[model samples]
Target: MYVYLSKIVPLFLMPLGLIIFAAVLVLLLLVTGRRRLAAWLLSFTVLLLWLAAMPIVAGSLYGRLESRFPPEPLARIPVSSCIVVLGGAVGLPFAPRQDIELTEAVDRVYKAVQLYREGKANRVFVAAGNQPRSESGPSEAALIGELLVEWGVPADAIQLEGRSRNTRENAVNIKPMLEATGCDRSLLVTSAAHMQRALASFKEVGLYAYPVSTDVRAIRRTEYTAMDFLPDAHALAMTSDAIREWMGQKVYQWNGWN
Candidate 1:
């Protein structure tokens, strides 16, 4: 439910949605002709306000979620029964061998497999559930699990959490599967920028999992120029992800998840 609401809210909050509202307001002003200038100004103001709230500006307005889960030496943590991998981003929807492709979130799946093989966890959990808006038809966890099998990891070694529709549900739904597999605690894998919310959601359910973040967002580009300011849709997408995660974190805290 949380995931569904979050995905839908953005359609009404972002620049595109606001642009439509602006156009309607502008049309209203032109039709009324009584306060044309004032109406135009109001419409433009609303558009500008929505743009300002875009995630591209502040990378979620809470800075990057990196510091919250710093890199820990693998040796520092104890091995567990399973390593949980949360899925979000998916590769091209219609690729012939789509399961093999990797996206920002898929990097966590690969990392989870590596951790499992390295003795960090005896089993791997792929939490690939997604909301209805997901363009990729397959549950992310299932796809990654297939990829893992293709990469030589036995199907028996993986636990796919495909029913969860959001982070909160990911935690809630995975509990029974983990219990069935005798996995009390496991490493939680996800993009570094999303670790804060993911961990909090799981923690809220009384499931303590170690953070193992991948798909870091910070760019170390030496050249910072006009392109940074220009609107790149991909950048906007990443920004939205960061912002959504931050919003999720706030929601979790408010719900006493922390």
Candidate 2:
């Protein structure tokens, strides 16, 4: 239930949806001859919303939230039951090409494989659940598992937790397996940008999962420049992800996950 709610909150909070309502309101206000008031208020509101999303305006906010946890050291190996990699890639069967492929989230699997190869963890658990809307339509875990196999991590060394639909559910569902296997702790593999929320969610469920973050997005820099302020879809997506993780952290805290 909580996992489903996490997916919905972002749609409403991001203002992508609310912008339509605000635009209609602005037009109605203008049509009624309150042009001056509408113009002033609308301009102010739009400016504020844009500013809220502007990377410069929100960079520090994202930085603070992202910095709550540092990236795990690549050289340091931790003891664990298994390295748990969270799912982000979805199988796309609707495309003209039919072969399975890696999506952006596949980095999570790659990092897990690297760790396993380095002997950081003896076993790997891919937590990929079903995305009903997907095309190839298998649980993300299955897709990642195949990738791991191709990468030469033997099939017997990998466990699939394909029942989880989201991070919260991933944590909820993986707990019993962890206990049953007599594993006390494990390294959690995910994007560096999303490690904070993932760790918090798992810990909330009483799992002591250490974070091994991959796919880092933010870089620390003292020099500010014009390009940093420019709006780019790729940058906006990263910023949005940062904000979503921060918001998820707050929600998890409210649920006593922290």
Candidate 3:
């Protein structure tokens, strides 16, 4: 229940969700015959959305988290005993397409592959964080594992973990697998915005992880084009993700999972 609530409750706290919430409140005010107040609230909501969609605002919010663990060259990073890539990189095959649908965060997988090929570890734990029997189809781990093997990573080198749906769960579920790897140190790979929560949760589980973050965003915009001020759907989505990652860290800390 906590898992489901954690996913659902954050919606109302982010950009689009907050906009919808305010819209509903405005509607209620209109139904109560408070036309002037409803108009005022509607205007406020529109402005909020516009600000959220602006690249400057969105990038500023996410940049803090994404820059926390900036990308480093493979040679600079110490080779750990194991590499774990968190889920959220791909979608399962369904219906018309049998191919995996890679998301923007697919760098998570590519980075893991690079680490493996470079002899960083003997095993790569590919976590798609879904139940194996997800009605949507196979777990993302299977697709990623398949991709890794096809990309020349040996099948024996990939350990597919399909039972985690979030960072906290990833830390919890992978502890045993990490133990089996018989390595004193391990590298945790995920989007830069997620490294904070991922590292914290792993610490709570008694595992000290080496942070290897990818998919960085702007920590600061040095120059602004006109596009920076314009409203963008992608910017709005980035804002939503930033809001969630920050809030999720707080929630985890509150629950003693961080």
Candidate 4:
């Protein structure tokens, strides 16, 4: 119940949920003949949606998170005991689909492979999981491990921690494996915006990892064009994602997970 609650409870605080709630309230007010209250709520919801879909707003939210961990070249980072790649890259071939569809975060997997090939680490640790009621199949760690082997990484060098379903669980589940392998230090590969929470979670579990970020979405510009103020679907998605990340990190802090 707690695991499911962890996943579902945060939605109520996000833009979509709040908008929906406000809209429903507006309708209720109208049914109760409270026209003025309904009008105010309807107007507020529209304004909220407009701001959330603006590229300028999206850019600012993403920039704050992505800018925290700037990318470093392979040469600049010292070789670590192992490479830890967090999940959200790809999933197994479910029924009706024989091929895995990779996500934007698939760069995490590619970067891990590059680090291994470049001798940055001899071993790679993939930390991923499926939700409680996910389609029954291989865990994401197994899928990622297979990809690593297909991409030239030796099969024996890959370690899979597949039961973790969130950032906190990722750190907790991988703890014993790192201890058993004596991987006292690691290179953590994940999306740039996600690195802040990922790094903190790992540290909470006593793992010392250096950041290796990828999939940065923040636009680098001293100024924005007029188009940036226009509403866009992609901008809305970015804004939602940035808000989720912020909310997740705050929740993690409150729970002492990081």
Model 2 lDDT tens row, 1-258: 555566776876664545556778788999999998888878876765575566675566656665766566678757667788898864644567586767776777888888888888788887878754552467778878888998879999988898887677788888887787776788898877677778878888889988887765566878988877765555555556666776777877787766
Across 56-151, the per-residue lDDT of candidate 4 in tens digits comes to 999999989999997889899888999999998996787788888788889999999999999999999999998877648789888999889999
TM-score to true structure, per model: 0.79, 0.87, 0.94, 0.95
lDDT of 4 at 147: 88
After superposing all C-alphas onto the true structure, candidate 2 shows an RMSD in angstroms of: 2.5
Q: How many clashing pairs per prediction, in order?
A: 1, 2, 1, 0
> lDDT per prediction?
0.71, 0.75, 0.86, 0.91
Best by lDDT: 4
lDDT of 3 by residue, 145-244 (tens): 9888888889988898887888888888888988877855888899999998898888899987899989776656578899999999999999999999
The model with the greater TM-score, 1 or 3, is 3
The best candidate in terms of TM-score: 4
By lDDT, is 1 or 3 better?
3
Query: Pairs clashing in candidate 2?
Result: 93-136, 128-141
Which candidate, 3 or 4, would have the higher TM-score against the true structure?
4
lDDT of 3 at 34: 100
Poorest stretch of ten by lDDT in candidate 2? 230-239
Mark the regions of model 1 whose C-alpha exceeds 4 Å error after superposition: 1-3, 34-63, 71-78, 89-101, 133-138, 220-223
Tell how far residue 232 is off in model 3, in angstroms: 0.7
